[model samples]
Target: MTDPKSSRLLDNRWDDAKAAGLSESQLLLYRSNLLGSDKRITNYGGGNTSAKVIEKDPLTGQDVEVLWVKGSGGDVGSIKIDGFATLYQDKLEGLKNIYRGLEFEDEMVGYLPFCTFNLNPRAASIDTPLHAYVPYKHVDHMHPDAIIAIAASKNSKELTKQIYGDEIGWLPWKRPGFELGLWLSKFAKENPTAKGVVLESHGLFTWADTAKDCYLLTLEIINKAIAWFETETEGKAIFGGAVTQSADADKRKAVAAALMPVIRGFIGKSESKVGHFDDQPAVLEFVNSADLRALAALGTSCPDHFLRTKIRPLVLDYDPARDNLDEVLATLEASITAYRAGYAEYYERCKHDNSPAIRDPNAVVYLVPGVGMITFARDKATARISGEFYVNAINVMRGASTVSTYVGLPEQEAFDIEYWLLEEAKLQRMPKPKSLAGRIAFVTGGAGGIGKATAERLIGEGAVVVLADIDEAALKTTEADFAKRYGADVVRGVKLNVTDEAQVLASYIETSVQYGGLDILVSNAGIASSAPIEETTLATWDKNISILATGYFLVSREAFRLFRRQKLGGNVVFVASKNGLAASPNAAAYCTAKAAEIHLARCLALEGAEAGIRVNTVNPDAVLRGSKIWSGEWREQRAASSHLQVDELEEHYRKRSMLKLNVFPEDIAEAIYFLASDASSKSTGNIINVDAGNAVSFPR
Candidate 1:
C-alpha cells in the first residue's frame, strides 16, 4: 500500500536556537543525536560520529586537538556526553609509526587506549580510527536504508557513478581497520573536490568543517538517494509483487501467538530467551513475497545487521491458504533442529584455529510466510532491536532487487566478523546475566502499590512485565512510570477486570502479541469486605468471592493453558492473606475468600507438578501503607475491629505481631520475588508468611 513515488521521507530537525550556545563537543553530540533519531538515517548502535575540538590538556595546560567520537557499543540516538570517547589527536597521528600493515591492523585496536585523552575510560570502538583519520573537523558515518540500498546493489559502483557523477566516491568492501582508514584518507586526498564516499556493502561517510554542515551534507545525500529510488522503482514490482496474500491482522497475530512459545521453548533449551513480534507493513510485504526464500538465503549485507540477526533466518513451513497451523507446529521441532545443525556447520567450516566455540546454534530471526517475523534474543530489548535491523535489511532488499540484483555480504567475510577476536573479547567482557533475565511476567493488579512493587522487583532482576488492572487512570500512570524508570520494552499495560473470564483470555492473548508469552503469573488482584455475619448480605459474599477467589481461578487457568503450550513449565504466586489461616472476627466473607485462594493454589500445585509448573502463596498481614484493600471502608472497619484509631493501626499491628513490626507492600514484594525466581524452584506448594512473625498466621 506504499506510494513508491512519494519522496519526502526524512526531516532535518536541526534548530539554530538549540545550537547557538553549545560547545563544539556538545554540538557534535546534538548533531549525532539528530541524525540517529530516524531509522532511515541509521539503525540503533549502527553508526559512529565525531568532532575535532581543541581543549586544554589537563597536565600541560596548553590547548591541544582532541578527537571526540562515540565510544564502543554506544547508540547515537540516546547517547549522552559521557558516552563519547576522547583521544589525543597527536597521539592518534603518532600510531602510524607503529602500524604493521594490513596483517596487523587488528593490533591497532590494542593501541587505541594508548591514545586516550585525559584518561577517559569510555574505550574507543573499531570505528574510532575511521572517524579519527578523516582529516575533517566534523565527520559522520551513517548506514541509512536508502544509501545502503544503493551500496548493497550488485552494480553498486556503477550505480554510485550514475547517482552522483563525481560528487561522491565509492570503495570496495574491506573489513574496517587501520588499512581501511588509510584507504579513506587516500580517497579523500585523491578526490579533493568530492564531498563523501560510500563503502561497498557497508555505509556512507561524510565530512565538513562545521558540525551543522556535516549534518546537512549527510541528510542531503541520503535525501537524494531516497528521491532517486522513488522515481527509479516507481512502477516496478516490489519483491516480485507478494506471491502470498497476507492474512488479516487478527489471524496473523493469532498465528504468531501460537508459534512464539513453541519457538521460545526450543531456543531457550540451554538459556532462556525472550521474543519480539513484528507485523509492520514492510515486514509483511517482504515475508509474503515470492523472493523471500531466495533473498533471505543470501543474508544481510551490512555488518551491523549481520551481527545482530545472524547469518540467515529460519523460514517456517507455513501457508496461510491452508491455515494448517497444526502441521506447522508438528514440524517446528525438526525445523529448529535442522537450523541448529546448519548453523554449527557454518561455524565449523568458516572458523579459524582460535575462533570461539560455536555460539547458540539457533537462528535469531524467524520468517513465516503470510504471518510475520519473530525474533528471539537473550532479552526483550535486544530481540526487538534485532528485529528492527532485519527490517532495515528488508528495506535494502526491496530497493536493490527492484533496481539491480541484490547482493549479501559474502559468507566467509561474515564469519570472520562474527568470530573476530576483538568481538569475542567484548563478548567475554559482558556482565553476568541476572537471575530472571529472559523471563516475562504478568501482574493482575499491576496498578496497585503491591503490584507495582512486585513488578519493580521482577524488572530489577531483568524480567519484562505486562501489567493488567481495571483502574484505567492508574494503569496508564503506572505504565508510564515503569516505562520511564525501566524501558519501554521492559513493560506494558492493559485494562482487565479479572472477574470477567472472556476479558481475562483476551488480556492473555494481548500479552502474547506484546511479548510472545508468559513464564510467570502473579495473581495479586483482590478486594476486602468486612461485615458482621448477621449484616453480611449475599451480594457482599458474592462480590468477595468473585474478585478474590473466582478471579484468581480465571487468571491461573489461562496461565496453565499458556504454560502447556510453551512446554517451558511456569511459575505462579498467589497473594493470599493472614486472615486465610486464622479466623478474623466480623470479616467472614473476606476471610473465607482468602482461604479459598490458598486452597486453590495448593490444588493447582498438585495438578501442575508433573509439568514442572510451581504454584505458591505469600500471606501478608495488615499491609496498610499502600494496600488498596485498606483504602476503602476496610481500613476503618479493621481499625474499629482492633479497638484503635485509623491512624494507630500501624502501631497496633506492630504490637500485636510476635516480632513487633508492621508489614508493608515491599515486604510482600520480596516474598513474591523469591517465589518467582529459581532460588525457590524446589520449594513450591508452600506458603511464605510475610506477616512479621504472626504465630497465628504461620503454617502449622
Candidate 2:
C-alpha cells in the first residue's frame, strides 16, 4: 500500500483541482499532465482523456451530457478544447457492444455522433470505449513509466508485488474495445478495493469520482514507487552550483524558469506550463558517474514513446577524459542487438498460442559518456521526466544485474503489452486528414506525356516532385521545361529505372533526404508493347511486366521503408491502364501486365492502409499524344490497314467511352493529381478511371 505520508500532498491536490472550477485551460492542462506521465497510456496521439460537460442537445430539447476528448492530430500536452471531439456520451456508450461479431469501418466508429455537433466534430479517438468504461468524472489512462518498467520485466507479477505491494491491481493485456471494457469491469468487481489496474504491456488506469482525485492518486502511486526505489538504492540527492536557493521549490522554480524559454523557442510556443524539474541528486551524480558507458544501453520501457523522449537521447558526461565516443556508441549498438536477440529467445520459449510476436522495442535509452541520460517521451515534459526516471532505473538495474540476470518480461508478456488491446485501439484512431501541404512527391517515368503531366500537376498543386525516369535525356528535357515554368526547385530530374532495384533504392534515398522525407510515390513509368496473343514472345512479356508491374513493386517497397520509419504516413499511386479492365484485340502481353498492376496496387493499399499509406491506381484509356505505340506513322498505317480514315480511327476510340471526350495525357495526369492530394485523403485501394469512362463498358 502507498505510504500515506508520501501521498498526503497528492490526495490534497485532488481536492484543490476540483475546487479550481475546471476551466477550459485547466482541463487541458490537467489532461496533458495525466496523459504525459505514461508512454503507452498515450503516445503521439494514442489514448485520450475526457471531461463530462453538460450541453443543450438540439434534437432532445433538453440539456445532455457530452464528452470532450482529444481530436485527430492534437497532442495532449497542449490540446485545447478545439482538439477534443465533443460527442454525446450516451450515444458513444451505446456503441460498446452493438455490432458484435462484426467489423464496421473503423473510421465510422465516431462518425455517427460527430455528424450531430454544431461544428462537425473531428473523429473521436478510437479507444473511446476504454475512456468511457471508467466510471469517473475525470479519467486518466497512461502507460506509466514505473508500471511499464515492472510489467516489462521477466517476473513482472513479482515485481509488481515487490514495488507496489497490494496498492494496485493487474489486468492481463487484452484487445481494446467492448471486450477490454468488459474484462476490466469484471476484474474490478473481483478486486473492489484496488486503487487502479495495470494493463500489461499496455499502460496504467486510474480514475476518480472527480478529475482532481484521479490526477492526485496517479501521482501518489508513482511517488510511492519512487520512494520505494530510493530506499532500496540508498541513492543520494545531488545539487550543483546554485546562485543561492533556500528551498527545494525555489531551486526547481529557477531552473524551470531558465529552461522554459529555450523549450518555447524550440517548439515555437509562447505559453507553456513549466513542470517543476526537481532532478534527484542521485540522478545527477549517476549521470556523471564513471559507468556512464554501461548505463546508456537501456532503451525506452515501452513502444510509441518516441514523441515524448524521441527514439533515443544524447547522454552527456562533463568529463573531458571520456574521449572514446566510438566505444560508447559501439557499446550501445551491442546492447541493442542483445536486446532484440533476447526478446526473440523469450518469444520462442514463452509463445505457445497463435498470438503474434513482438516486433520492435517500444523505447530506447541512450547514455552520453559524459552527459546525462535521455529518455523517450512523446512530449517535451515527458521526455524530461523520462530522463529523471532513466537515472533511477539505471541505478536499480546496475545493482540488480549484479544480483541476478536482469531478464525482461518474457516474450509472451512483452507480446501481450506490445499487442495489448488498448495499444491496438490506438490503431483504430484514424483522423480525418487535413491538407497535403509540406509533403514531398516523386513520380517515375516523368519526362513527357502522362508522366510529365503528373509531375507538372503535382508541382502546380504545391507538392515538391522529384521527376525520375530511365530516359535520362527525356528526364533532363522535362526538368528543363518544368524548371523554366515552375522554377528549378519545383521539379527535379533524376535518371532511374524502376525495374532496376539498385537504381530504385538509390532514387528513394536521394529523394527522401533531399525532400526531408517522401510523402507520395507515383509509379507512372511503363513502355507500351502490343501484339496478337500468339505473337507475344516470352522476352517481350517479361520486359513489359518487369517495368509495368515489378518496377512498381521495387519503388513502392523502397518508399514503404522510409515512410514506415518516419511514421508521417504516405500515399502511392500506380498509373495502370484501362486495358487492365477491358482488353482490346491484339494487345495480349500489355493487357496482362496492366491487369497485374491493378491487382498489385490493390494489395498494397490493403497492407499499407494501417500505416496511413494510401495506395490507389489511375487507369486511363489510350492517349495518342505520347504513347510509343501510337505515333503518326503507326496511326496512319492502322487507319489504312483497317480501311478507315485517320480521323475515323481516333473517333472510334473516343466514342468507346461513355463521356466521348478525347482523353489526353493531361486528363490521366489530373486523376493522379487528385489521388496524391489531400482532396482524396480518404481514398485508398480504389481504381479511378481516367479513360473518359471507356473502361466502364465491362465491370468486374
Candidate 3:
C-alpha cells in the first residue's frame, strides 16, 4: 500500500463504473490495485495476484487461456499491466508430464521460461505454480497481518476451521513451490465448497471465477479475520501488556536522534547502510512490552516477513524508566558485537552444506525499549521497508498471542528459505548500486537554482538529500518536486537560517534523526550584494559576513561533529565565487566575505585531514541564468559595472570568458558533484573553477 497515512477501515475502493469498460486482463489489474491499496490487505512487495484470461494467440488467431501472474520482485500495490508474467495455461498444465516429484519441484522453475505465451520478458515468480494449479479463474495470495495472525497460531488448523468454517480449508505447511501448488490444488478439489484455504505458518489464499469477486472475497476473508481478532482479544492484554510506559512523542524522537548515529557508526564499519526510525504506537507498544525479547527472539512466521526483516530483531538492553541513554551509547558496540555473534551462530547451526557462505552477520532491525525501532539497510527504501515488515510481524504476534499461542516458523525452515539457492541467485541478479548509493547529503541554499541542480545531481547517483533553505516556501516547492521525482523517502526539506546558530544546531539534529548522518555537505547557501566601498553600510558588511562567513563555519562545525560521531569520514564542498579569488569592481563586501569562505575551507581541510575529511571549494562566476542572487540588484549592478545592459549580462559574461562560453548553475553543480563524491577524494583543500575559463579569477 502507498501509505494512506491514516488508518481507515477496509472498504472496497472498487468503482464499478471505472472497471466497466476494461478488458478481462485490465479488470484483473484493477482488482489487484484495490487489494494492494491497503497495507491492511498486504505489504509493499508482499503477496501475489493472478488471472486466467482468454486471449488470441500471438502465433495463431485461435483463442487460448493465458495465466497472468505478478512477476518476481514486483509489488502488486504499484504494479502495472506490463508487470505481470503471461504464460499459456496449456503449456503450464503440460509441466505435469515432466514433474518428477517434490524433490524435483525446484527444477519446475527452470522450465517456466519455455511456457511464456508472448515472449514477455518479465520473469515468473516461484508462486506461479501455486496460482496456476488453482481451479478458480482469479486468485489472490496475500500475507495480510490479520490472516497471518490466525495462520501463525499454534492451533492454526483448528482456528481456521472455527473462524472460517467449511468455506475456508486448512493445509499443512510446505515450502512454496510445485509441491505446495499440488497440495493447494488437491485441497481445493476435495472441498469443492471452500472459497479459500489457510496455509499453516504461511498466509491466506482466496479465489473466485471472476476478477471482482476474487478481489472482494480476499478482502472479506481478511476483514473477517481482523474482526474476529478484535472481538476475541477485546479485553485481553497484548504482548503481555506493555510492561514499561512509552516515552512521550518528543522524548522518543530525541532518544532516536541520539542513538541512531552511534548504532550506525558501529554497524556501518564495512559497507555503508542508511537508517530508518519508527516510534509509532504499534512499535512503542511492542518495544515496551514484557515479551518484547522473547517474542522477538521467536522471530516471524510468514516467509515474506522473514526474508525482509531477517530471522529476528536485535533487542537492546534499555530501561525506559531509568532513561539510560548515555549508558546505551557506551555499550552500543558491545550490544552489536553480541548480536553479530548470535547471527553467526544461527547461520552456522541452520546452514546446509550448500548454503551461501554466511551472508552479512549484522541484524537489520534493532529494538530499543523507549526509543523504538531502528532499521538499517543498503539504502533508505530498504531500511524503511524492513521496518514495515517487522511491523507486520509485530501485528501478527499481537493478534496470535492474544487469541492463541503465537508460533514462529521453525529455525530449520526459516534457514532453508533465507539461504535458498534461487533466492541467492535473485540477490546476485540485482543491478549494481548507483555511484552515490548509501551516501547521505546535506545541501544548503537548497531552494535556489544552483542548490536544486546540485541536489538533483547527487540524488541521481542515489544519495539521500536533506535540503536546507532559508526560504520556507521555496523549500517546500523544491522538496515536493524532488519527492515526486525521486520518491519521498530519498529527499527531505528543512527550513534553516545559517546565520542563526540555534537553528543550525536544531537542523543538524533533525538531519541526524531523519537520516542517520550525512557523508557529504554542499555548503552553497548565499546572497549577493553590489556597492562602492564607502557606500557599503555596516549592515551590508555584517550581512555578508554573517551568512557567507559565519554561516559556513556554523554548518561546517555541525557537520564535523556528526562526521566524527559516525566515524564515516566526510566530504565538504564550499560554493564560493570567482570574486573570492579575484577582486570585482565595487562589490567589496561580497568579495571579502567570499574570500573568507575560501580561506575557511582551507583551514578546515588542514584540521580534518587526520580524520579523513576532505574540504574543497568550487568558484563560479557570472552564472546569470537560474541564480537567485543574480536575479536581484546584483545582476543590474554587475551589468552596470561591466558597461552593459541588464539583458546583455549573459552575453557579456560569455564573451568575457577565455572559452567564450556561458557559465550556468548546472556547470557549478557539476564541479560540486565531483568534490562531494569520492572522485575528488585525493584532492582536498583544492578549488575547481567553473566559470567557463576565467584566467583572471583562476585560483593561484
Candidate 4:
C-alpha cells in the first residue's frame, strides 16, 4: 500500500499545479520543485527532470521535438523555464550512431553539446540521454533516501523485484553516459509495460505520458519500499541514541571545543585545504550511534555522493573522559595519515592509464564518537553539503540494515565517480570563495543597525555569524530574516546584554560549545548620551560608561579567555566613534566613554600580541541614518548644537567632511572586516578612521 503521507503530498502538489493553469513545462517545473523541496528525495543538485515538447527552431523557424532537461548547477526547487536546457530529440538520437562504443568522458565532452537546439549555452545534465530515450513525455529521476536504501542493498535486484513486482526493470550499476542510456533504451523496448527502472547503487527513474503521472509513480515506488522496510524492522533496534547525561554532555562539549582548533590547524597547513567543524544535533546523533564505526566503514551508498563525500568516512576514536586533548591530537594526526595512505592505496587499486590525477586526500566527513562529526573541505558550502549528504546516507544505511544486510557501491565504482573528468570540470567551473570561508564570528548588538550591517557583511564573505543582542524581539526577527536570506546554518541569534557579566560569559560559552570555537569578535555594542559637562548627571555618565566602555571590556575578556583555552589566534575589532578621537561640543559623556573603550582595545592588543591575537579599532563619524544613537532626543540635541534642523543635520555632516561623502554603517563594517581578516594581519594596536575624510579625527 502507498504511504498516506506521500500520497497526500503528491496529490496536493498536482492539484495545485493544475489549478494554477500551468503549461507542460510549468507543470514539469512544479513537479521538480516538489521533489527538490524534500532533502529525503534529492539534495542540493543531485537530481534531474525533463519534459518533451515541440518548439520552433530559431534558425530554421521549423517546429521540432525538443527535450527540455534540468540544466547543470540549478537547484530543482527554484528552477525557471530557462533552467531547462533545450535539446533537439533528432539531433540527440543521431549521437547514438556517431558516438557508438565511445568512453564515458569522450561521449560527454565531445558529442553532448552538439545535441542542443538553442544558442543558449547552459550544459544539459549528464542523464539527458536517458530522459530522451524513454518513450514517455515526462521523466523524473532522483536519489530518494528510501529508494537508495533498497537499491544499494546486498541483494538489490531480488529486493526490487519483491517490492516492485515485474513492472520494474533493474539496471546494473554503470557510469552515467552513452552506454547506460543505450542499455536503458534496450530495457524499455523489451519490457514495454515497466512503470519504472531501478539503477543499482545509483537512483530511480520513472516516466509517464503526464508529469503528474510520472511524479506520482516515483513517489508510489519510494513509499512502498519505505513501508516494507518499516514493517520488516518493527521492534528491531538498529541504532542506539546518544549518551546525554549531564557529565557526558559537558565532556563532549569540552573535547569538541578543544580538538576543533587542532584539527583545523592541521588541515589548514596546506594553502589549498581548509576545514570546518560542526556538531549539530543530527551529527551528534549519528556519531553517538552504537554502530557508527561499523556502518561508516561501508562505502558510500551511491556514486554521486562519492563526489561530495569520499568513498569512506574517516572514523576517529575519542573517549571524552579517558583521553586527554594532547593524546587525542596525536592519535588524530596518526589517523589522518592512515586515511591518506588508504586513499592512495584505493586509487592505485582502481586507476587505469586514462584515470584523472588523484584528488586531495582529505576526508570530507570525520566521525568522532563523543565529539560528533567534523566535515572538511576547501570552503564552507562544500563542507556543509558534505555533512548533509552523510547524515542522509546514515539514515539510509540504518533502514537498509534493519531490512537486510546493508551494502554500498564497491570501492572501485566509487573511485571512478570521484575522479570523473566531468566532476573535476564542475569543481573547476565554480568561483573561488572569500578568504574567511570556514571562520565563525560573533557580533554584539547585532539587532541594531551597525551591528546587523556588520554581520551581513561577514556572512557575505562566507563566515558563520552569531548575533548577540539585548532586544529579544528584534534579535529573533533579525535571526529569522538572516536565516531566510542565507541558509539557517549561516547565522544564529543569542539574547545577551553585554553589560551583564553573566550574560556575556554565557554567550561565549555557548558559541564555543555549539560551533567548536570563535574566530572573530566584533565589539559593536554601545549607547550614546549627549549633555553639557555641568548638566550631565552622575547616573547619565555611569550609564554611558557601563555600556560603551565596560561592555567592551566584558565581551573582550570572555573572547580572549576562550582563545587562550583553545590555543588558537583570534581577531577583535572595536567599533569606536569619531567623537572619541576629537571631542564634539556638548557630547562629553559619549565622547569620554568611547575614548576609554579605544584605550582599552590598545591595552588588550599589547597583552594579546604574545598569544597571536590582533586587536584594533574603527572610528565612524555621523552615520546618521539607521543609527539608533542618532535617534530620539539625541538627534535634536546634535542638530541644535550644529545650528541646523534635524533633517538637515545629516547633509551638514556629509558636507563637513573633506570628501563630502555620506558615511553609512556599511563603511564602518568594511573597515572592521579588514582588521578582522588577514588583510591587516601584520598590524594591530591600530585605529582606522572611517569618517569620510574628517581631518580633525584623523589617526596620528
TM-score of each: 0.98, 0.42, 0.98, 0.90
User: What is candidate 4's TM-score against the reference?
Assistant: 0.90
| Tens-place lDDT digits, model 2, residues 1-700 | 3565753222333345454777643664565655554442344444556666677788767987776666655667556656777777787666654646324424335444643354645666555666655655666666544556555455556766776766677776554555566566566567767767776645677666656666677776666655554455454322212212222433333323222222222221211111213344544454555444443334334433422333233443223253443453335435545545665665566554554544443233434322333333222334445554454344444433332233333334445545544445654564532244345688888885888888777777656678998888878888998888877655667899888888886676556333435678988887766566688799988998898889988999988876675555679999988888886666677788889989999999889999889999988776877764566455665566467887787787778668888888888888888898878999999988877776353446
Candidate 3 structure quality by residue, lDDT tens digits, 413-444: 99999999989999999999888898999999
Identify the superior model by lDDT, candidate 2 or candidate 3: 3
Candidate lDDT (C-alpha), each: 0.92, 0.60, 0.90, 0.80
- lDDT score, candidate 2, position 150: 54
For all candidates, the clash counts are 0, 31, 0, 0
**Which pairs of residues have clashing backbones in candidate 4?**
none
RMSD values for the candidates in order, in angstroms, are 1.9, 17.6, 2.3, 3.4
lDDT of 1 by residue, 24-88 (tens): 99999999999999999999999999999999999999999999999999999999999999999
Flag the better candidate by lDDT, 1 or 2: 1
lDDT of 3: 0.90
| Deviating ranges (above 4 Å) for candidate 4 | 1-12, 16-20, 100-105, 239-262, 269-286, 319-334, 348-358, 370-372, 378-381, 484-489, 509-516, 561-568, 584-588, 640-645, 655-661, 693-695
RMSD of candidate 3 to the truth, in angstroms, is: 2.3
Candidate 2: worst 10 consecutive residues by lDDT?
Answer: 267-276
Ranking by lDDT: 1, 3, 4, 2
